[model samples]
Target: MDLSGGTLEIVVSAVVISISVPGNILLIYCTRRCIDEQLRTSFTLIFSLAWTNLIYNLVVNILKIVYASNVELDSAVCKVLMFTAVFTTSLAIWFTLYIALLFCSKLCRVVHPPVEAACKNYQKFHMVLVFTLWVAGVAVCCPVLLYTRRIEKLNTENETYQQFSSLIYTECKTEYRNDLIEILYGKIFLGAINLLPLLIMLLTGFRIVYLLWEHRKATYGGIWIGGDASELEVVRACKIILLLIFVITSFCVSYFSLVYCLKNFKSCYFAPPVLTVLSSGYSSVSPYLLMLINYKVIVRMRCFCCKDEKKLVTVSAIAPVSPYA
Candidate 1:
């Protein structure tokens, strides 16, 4: 049995929504509650990324479901969907890169006291930086609003339409005013959102790895005595950051490769479902990974569970003390 393109899209969208919605909501709730005076700037970035992912999943996937059902939607719906997809994805990528840079700065601070002093000053401007990213994303993706239009299938019996229908949504498509505009916009959009950020992440990830290796060698050689718990936590967080870089990089590479194939070779029938997975995969997955290294969130959850367990123990003749407490 073979599924149509619409069916494939609906299945993929549904799965992404199921995972992304709850994960992002919980991530947002946890990060919001954990924010404080000292960690305000850092957790703010996490909160923003979670918020962006949740919005993307809700807007894009819901619209995709409606479109895939073959319901006749207005051209504006297509424009909103495309614009949201591009804008949200760009914001998510830049936010993740921001996080990697934050970790790199911390590691540099450890290696050079002057760098740490500079980072302390830089922290004051983080909110402004975040605002700028949002504005920049809007500027880059605004053109998409004008170019995207509803794709109409006028003749159902057309051989070309039947052949390529499995690979594209019959309701929405993007068309620039001219080839030059399309080429120019494509290069700038791809470079800014995907290629350049990916390159920076890779470089930052390498710097983090080298710093950790150096720290470990020093600790083992007895140059640094009795590693502090905070230092250990930083090491753990850096490792998680490396994992995140890997996840985002893999998805980025897969998405662009499939997109290239679809554009160049018109017979890429399997591209739709795979492209859907690649497009939303990182957004759906990264929140949970961030939660793993969030000590405050972990502690709060444990305390909540312990309280529930204590409530159950009240019915017993003798209550057991919780290890968590």
Candidate 2:
């Protein structure tokens, strides 16, 4: 097959898959070995996001490959793939915000949680919170699947855009069935899936930072650092790294989402392959950055697998007898 688009899709998707698969697995391992329960929920959210990103990258890339190779799927399969790809990415970002909030709560102690700290039952509350997030992501995705369709078309020179599966069918000249209700449905997806949640995440991060400063904590660095005061130096280091990564990742995601939405209105807009690779690269970089800059995490890592060495000399001496005895 003379496949230019397929090549581009594979190149971009390959980068996404390669980075995400191992990155998530390693992040899961790191989380498992961590002993500090203080940031457990935050790390759990990161872990969940990393793993979900892996799944999304794998599924979407495989479909990209299969579809690029001219493989066809029924409406049901198309619906499932689109729903999953869109939903899971949203889930990853939403849960990541929850991660940020969990940390901010610790730093600012803003909303006192119903459960006590790091108790066995704490996980119960955690599950409820995470599940609600998952449900919300899926619910938002429903509109995307309803509005979108897997389409095939031929441009000049018989060049095909098969994997350009999603299209605004309202203006499609061919006899492919288009529904007015679905167009309205597209607006729902455009707002809910892409715009509203994104705005919420951005605002949540800002509110968290503001609250931290307002409370007179997180002055030099981030919201909170609860351990040894002397360790505050290391904590400050970690905070700088984390905040920088968070800011960068947020910008990339926002930029990509804005472009994706604006481009969707027309037949085809800019699909810069390089930008796709850059967006996909974020997943791989995030976890390593965490491990690299987090001093407490590193200390805990050493504790998990290593024994303390405090070698010393011994001297023997006789004890004096008690006068009464």
Candidate 3:
């Protein structure tokens, strides 16, 4: 039995969506629990990230599965799916950039404590920023809806179709009515979407690592130096920041692989589904990492497992502690 590209895509996309959607929802729930119980608003970017991932999995991957399964769709439906998929993908990229920026700002505070107040005040505007990012996503994807149309062509290459003489195959494709618009949208707009945000994430992630290294070296050269609680807190924060940076780096590398394959080897029969898996690699994986960073999820899981424990012992042993504490 030959496993075709479309079959592989359907299987991979279905698995990815099934896993990522629930993981992102759980991350959101964990983030909310942290906020309500621990009074930590730092979950803002994390929540936004999870939400965007959820949307991408729900919209993009699900549609990919449907398309892979050869479901018939009208031009309108195809346009909507393509536009939504692109919009959510763009939103995910922007949210990652926002997270990198936020972490960078937090590290800046470690260098100059005086900026802490300004950072907190700035964070108060995160909601407005998120809303603006969503608007930008919609604007960028508008062309996809406008230019996309369903096209049908004869499957002349198919040996099975030889007996039938002709078989029609349909696909949703962008129609560039204007050459200038095509060049601008393809070379400039889509180029930025693919490269710019990832570059920002890369630069910020490396800068963060450098700053953390310097801080760690200045505080603890080689051996264990007994430091105050704030110093310890900074170390923990640096570790978490490093973990998230690693996640971002993975996302960049995987997405770059997909883009590179599509651009250079478009004719490869096995590449598309493999690239789709790579494309969703980060979204499916990052939520669990973020949940681990939240700490609340671990505590909640422990509480559920030890529900029969004495209340006094539980309170004394596992009482919620401030992240900085």
The candidate that wins on lDDT is 1
User: Which residue runs does candidate 1 get wrong by more than 4 Å?
Assistant: 1-4, 111-121, 154-170, 264-267, 303-307, 311-325
Query: Model 3, 11-121: lDDT tens per residue?
Result: 888888888998888788767665642334457767878888888788777777776555666788778777876777677777777766765665566644563354234
Candidate 1 RMSD computed on C-alpha atoms after optimal superposition onto the true structure = 5.6
Give per-residue CA lDDT, model 1, range 48-115, as digits (tens).
89999998999988887776566678888889988998899888889999988886776655544362
- List per-prediction Cα lDDT, in the order shown: 0.74, 0.53, 0.65
Counted clashes in each candidate structure: 0, 0, 0
Count clashing residue pairs in model 3.
Answer: 0
- Name the 10 consecutive residues with the lowest summed lDDT in model 2: 316-325
List the candidates' TM-scores in order: 0.87, 0.65, 0.81
How displaced is residue 137 in candidate 1, in Å? Answer: 1.2
Displacement of the residue 302 alpha carbon in candidate 3, Å: 4.6
Model 1 clashing residue pairs (backbone): none
- Locate the minimum summed-lDDT window of 10 residues in model 3: 161-170
Residue-level lDDT of model 2, residues 90-186, one tens digit each, is: 6766665566555554444332224554534365588688878877777766665665464555554523443333222211111223566445554
TM-score of 2: 0.65
Which whole-number lDDT from 0 to 100 does residue 212 have in model 1? 86
Give the Cα error of residue 221 in candidate 2, in Å: 14
